[model samples]
Target: MAKGYWITFYRSISDPGALAAYAKLAGPAITANGGRFLARGTAAKAYEQGIAQRATVTEFDSLEQAIAAHESAAYQEALKALGSACERDVRIVEGLG
Candidate 1:
């Protein structure tokens, strides 16, 4: 089954340079693991009040593939560089059967 990963980030972005650096590092890792970016930085027009500054959704061939991607060494390095610069909410879900 396909797997989906959703990530929401609320970041003030103290450093755009750092964000770009991290993106460069992580983007390739995901692609290498057979992941595809579905939506990124998509604005949500309707909500009660609080909302994430950015929302991203990605799909992988399988749940194991998704998990493996996140657990990969390259991604972990990129995630580490991200530090506490942003608050992130991430979830991995199996697609409908």
Candidate 2:
């Protein structure tokens, strides 16, 4: 099966502390569910209208695993910690090959 990826874009961040807390929980949660970070942080440049202030990409062994990581209790805790501290978009996609 094709690999899966989680792509997240942060449009704005109103609370750094909340984001930090979310990251702390989310990182371990993702890893435990077979997800690995590929890229994270602000973009070097924006050449498109949809680009946000920050972007994150995580790879997973399969689409199911990617979705599972997002739904897992640990990640849910992270989301609760975040609690609208930022505006962001997240997408899960299957890799090309």
Off by over 4 Å in 1: 42-46, 49-52
Across 27-92, the per-residue lDDT of candidate 2 in tens digits comes to 999999999999999988888676648899999999989999999999999999999899998999
Worst 10 residues of 2 by lDDT: 43-52
Q: Model 2: residues >4 Å from true position, as ranges?
A: none
lDDT of 1 at 11: 41
TM per model? 0.82, 0.95
Per-residue lDDT value at 10 in model 2? 91
Candidate 1 lDDT over 1-97, as tens digits, reads: 6665645555455766666777888889888887899888746753776564766687888888888989999999888777766666778778876
Worst 10 residues of 1 by lDDT: 4-13
Pairs in clash, predicted candidate 2: none
Model 2 clash tally? Answer: 0
lDDT per prediction? 0.75, 0.93
